[model samples]
Target: MNTAAVVADFRTYPLISALGSVQTLADRVAVEWADGRISPFHHVWLRDNCPCQQCVYSVTREQVFEIVDAPDDLQPTAAHIDAEGCLCLDWHDGHRSRFDPGWLRAHAYDDQSRAERLAGQPQSHLWRSDLQLPVFEYTALMEDPAALLQWLIAVRDIGLTQVRGVPTAPGSLKLIAQRISFIRESNFGVLFNVQSKADADSNAYTAFNLPLHTDLPTRELQPGLQFLHCLVNDAEGGESIFVDGFAIADALRSEDPASFQALCEIPVEFRNKDRHSDYRCLAPIIALDALGRVAEIRMANFLRGAFDTSVEQMPRLYRAYRRFMAMTREPRFRLMQRLNPGELWCFDNRRTLHARNAFDPATGARHFQGCYVDRDELLSRILVLQR
Candidate 1:
C-alpha cells in the first residue's frame, strides 16, 4: 500500500487520550481529541516522521535508527485515519512514517519506556534433551507432507529430532532442512566438520568429529538446532553420544550447591580464531533460567580459552569442573547412537551435549552433511500449528 493508505489506517486508533476523531483531505488532515482538540495538517506530511525507518531510508539501506531528536526541518503537512485507527501523515520532505495509533496509545506516555522482546518460551520446553526426541520413519515425512511440517516444528521447539531410512548424501541433509524451513539463510549450518588438517581450528568447517558440547557458546547469539546427516558410517569408533547438559548442571546444583554457585560466579572465556575469522565470548560455565533453573551448560574443551582464575579460585574451579565431568560421564544421562548410513541425528545444541567416540580414520572415512535452524522459528511453527 502507498504511504497515504498506511497513514490513514493508523489514525483511526485513539492515540492520545484527548484525541477523539480524525479527518483526512487530499492536502491536509485534522484530528479531534476527546476534549475537542484538533491539529490540522497534511496527514502525509505528519507520517514522514514515523518512528519506523521505512519512512527515512532507501530500500537498499532500510535500517532503523534511534529517533531521539526530531529534526527541526521535518514538519507534518496532512493527516488522516485508517481502518486500524492509526494516524497517517504527510511530510513536507516527501517521506512518510505512519503513527500507529495503537502504538502511540500504548507507549506515548513515557519516552524512555523500553520495548521488551516478547517473553521467550520456557527454556526447558524449548531445549529438551532427554524426552525421547521424535524419530521419523524416513518415508513418512516425505509421503505425508503435513506430518513432515509438524515434525519440523517439534524439532524446532526442542532444538532437535532424528530420522531413519533417508539416503545419506552430501545434499540429503539440505533436503531435510529445507523441509524444516528453508535453512534459515543466515548462520545456516554446522559449526564444525572434521577434516584431515593437523590443526582443527584452522579448518573448523570441514568434516570432523566434535566432542560433547554446545555450539556457539562464544557467540552473542548462538544457532539453535543442529542437523547431522550421516552419508557414510563405515569408519570405526565414531558413535554419536549426547548428554543432557542441563540435567548434569541441575544435578551438580542439587548435590553440590557450592560448586554450582562457584560456577555461576566465575566467567569462562571461549575463543576460536583462524586465518580468516576470530570469535570470542565470555559466559559462565552454567547458565540459569529466570526462575533459577539450570538452563544450559556450555562446556567445550576445544573452544575453552584461558580460565583467568586466580590462585585462590583455581582449586575450586578445578574441583567443580572435575565434578561436572564425572557427572557427565555417568550412563543415565547419556543416549548413544551409531548413526549409520541413511541415518540422521539432530539435537537441540543449546541443551544437549554431544560427543564422538574416537573413530578410526585408517578403516574408512565417516562423512556427514550438517545444517541448522533457529529455535524461535521452530517453536513458532509449532504454536501456529496448534492454534
Candidate 2:
C-alpha cells in the first residue's frame, strides 16, 4: 500500500487506556498511559520492533524479523495489558509480542514527545576568551578512563581542550586520535602534514595568516573534531588563534538581532576546487538544531563562493556577514596561544573557528600533524568511558 493509505489505516486504531480500558482496531493498537498521554502503534511497527527472542536476538539485541516478509494487512488477533503494564499482543500470523509501556511512550512519534526529546538534548557550555582551556596530560588520557572522559566532556561542552606531553614522533598523532575513534579521511588523507609546502593545494599549507574559520565547509558533512599535534614549532610568528563560534553567534543575537537573523536565514555557498576534487555546499552561516540551539557555524572567507542572492538581499547578507566576522575577531572572543612541541590541540570543528598567524617559514621550521574525528564517536567514547 501507499504511504498515505498506510498512515490512514494506522491511525484508525482507537486510543485505549493502559489501566482502565483496552481497545484494539484493525491492524493497530493504542495505549493511554497513567499520565493521560495517548499514543497509537501500528501493527507493522510493533511486529518489527518485537522484543521476543524469536523476533530479536537475545545476545546481540538486534532485530531479526524481516519487515518485507510480513503480511501487509497483518493485524493483532488479541491485545491486552499484562500485569506489569506491558502491552501483550497475539498477531493474526500466530506470533506473540510484548512491549513495555514506558518504552512505547518514550519512542512515541507524537509532536509533543518529539519536541520534549529535542529540548532534553545536551547543549554546549559556551565559553569566552577569559575561560581557561581545559588541559590533560597524555599519560593520564592514555591510562585513566576518568581523565579521558573529562577531556572528551571538555571538548563537547567548551569546544576545545589540549593534551600535553604527546609523543613528538612522526605519525604519533594518529595513535592519539585512534584512542578516541577512527580517523575521518579527507582529500588530505588520513593524517595530513601542516607545513609550508611548494605548490600547496590549499592555503593551510602556506605560512600566510589564516583567518578564524571552520575547516572544509565546502563539504556537506564537515569534520566534527580536529586534532592538530605540534611536532615542530621552531618558527617565530605562528601563534594559533581560536574563537568560540557559538559564543560569538550568541553575542551577535543579543547585540544585533537583525544581523543574527540574517545570518541564520541566508544560505551561503562554500566551494573548494583543486586538481583532485571539487567540493561545494550551501548552508547558513549559523545553523540551528530542531530545538533552536546553535548546532554549527560554517564560515570560511577563503572558501566562500560568489554570492548568488538577489540585489535586495545581498546588502543585508553582507552586513550580517561583516558583523559576524567582526565579532569573531573581537578581543573578548579571541584566544591566542603558541602550541609547543608534543602538545595535541583538539577542538570541535563545528563550534570553533581556528586561525594561524603568519610565520617566517624561511627562518625556522614549523610542522603539525592533523586528523579528523566525528563528534558522534567522541561522544560515544565518552559514554563508554563513563559506563
Candidate 3:
C-alpha cells in the first residue's frame, strides 16, 4: 500500500497514533492502535465510508456509493495492516477498501476515541452581568483575518460582542456583515431600520419597551448572528439591555427542575402576522441538541400566540413560562448599555436575549440598521479562516 496515495475526505486528519494490529471479527474488525486503544470498525460502517474514486466523488468529496448496494451479510475476507500503516481489506464480493491510519484513528469508535473527539468540540462560555464584554475594533476586524476570526470566536462562545469605530453611515452594516457571508434576508428586508415608525408592523419598529427575547421566534430556523449597528442614538431612555439566555436557563435548571422540564417538554406557538406576511412556528421554547445541552432559546413575548397545551398542563406551562421570563428580568443577568454611533453589536440571537427601553421620540432621534447571518455561514467562515 502506498501511504502517499491514500486519500481521505477534504479534511486533513493528522496522524495521532500508528496502527498496531488488526483482528478480523465476524461482524466487525477490531483495530489496535500504537497508543493501546482498541477500536471496533463495523463492516458496514467501513464499507460505507470508502474513499475510493468509485465510492466517493473526487471533485465534491461526497459519497457516491450507497451502503444499500452492498450485501446485507457483507464481510471482509482479509484484513491486515499494510507496510505503510494503512488498513487494507478485501471483501468477499471482490470489493477492496483502503483506510488511511490518520483518518481511521480520527474516526475510531472506541470509548476513549469518542470521548477525545467530544472534548475537542468548541464549548460555549456562559456569562452574566459582570461579563467583560468582548469588544473589537471595526478597523482591525475589517482589515485583518486574525482580528475577524477572534471576533467571530467571541460571538460563538460568549454569544455577545461589540465592535466600535464602525462607519456612521446609512447601510454601512452591510459591508461588515458581508465579511462573514451573505446576509440572511427576512421579510423585514436585508438591513432593517430600527427607528420608531408610526405604522410599524412589528413592535421592534416602534418606541416600545421590547422585552428581552430572541428575534424571529416565528421562523422555523431563527437567525444565528445578529448585527445591530447604531448610526445615531441621541434619544433618551432607549438603553439597550441584554441577558444571557443560556445563563438564565442554567439557573432555571438548577433552582427549578420541574419548571425547566416543563419548558423543555412543552411545545408552544409563536406567530408574527401583518397585512402582508404571516409566519408561525410551533416548537419548544427551549431546544436541546443531541447531547441534551440547551441548543437554542426561542422567545418573543410580543410575537407569542395563545397557549393551546392540554388544560391539565396549562398551569405547569404558565409557571415555567413566568419563571423564565422573570429570570430574564433579573438584574443579576441583565447587561444594560447604551450603544453610540459607529458602534454595532454582533450577538447570538438564539442564545442571548435582547431588549430596548421605550424612548421619547420628541427628545431626539435614534436610528439603527440590523442584519442577520446564518449559523452555517458563520461556521464556514470560521473554518476557512482557521485553514
Question: lDDT score, residue 51, model 2?
Answer: 71
Model 3 lDDT, full chain set: 0.92
The number of the candidate with the highest lDDT is 3
Q: lDDT by residue for model 3 over 52-171, one digit each (tens)?
A: 888988887788899999999999999998878899999999999999998888888888989999999999999989999999999999899999999998999999999999999899
TM-score of each: 0.62, 0.81, 0.96
Report lDDT (CA) for all predictions: 0.64, 0.85, 0.92
Q: Rank the candidates by lDDT, best first.
A: 3, 2, 1
364 Cα displacement, candidate 1 (Å): 1.7
lDDT of 1: 0.64
Question: What is the overall TM-score of model 2 with all chains considered together?
Answer: 0.81
Clashes of 3: 0
Instruction: List the candidate 1 regions with Cα displacement exceeding 4 Å.
Output: 1-133, 142-146, 149-160, 182-210, 310-312
| Order of quality (TM-score) | 3, 2, 1
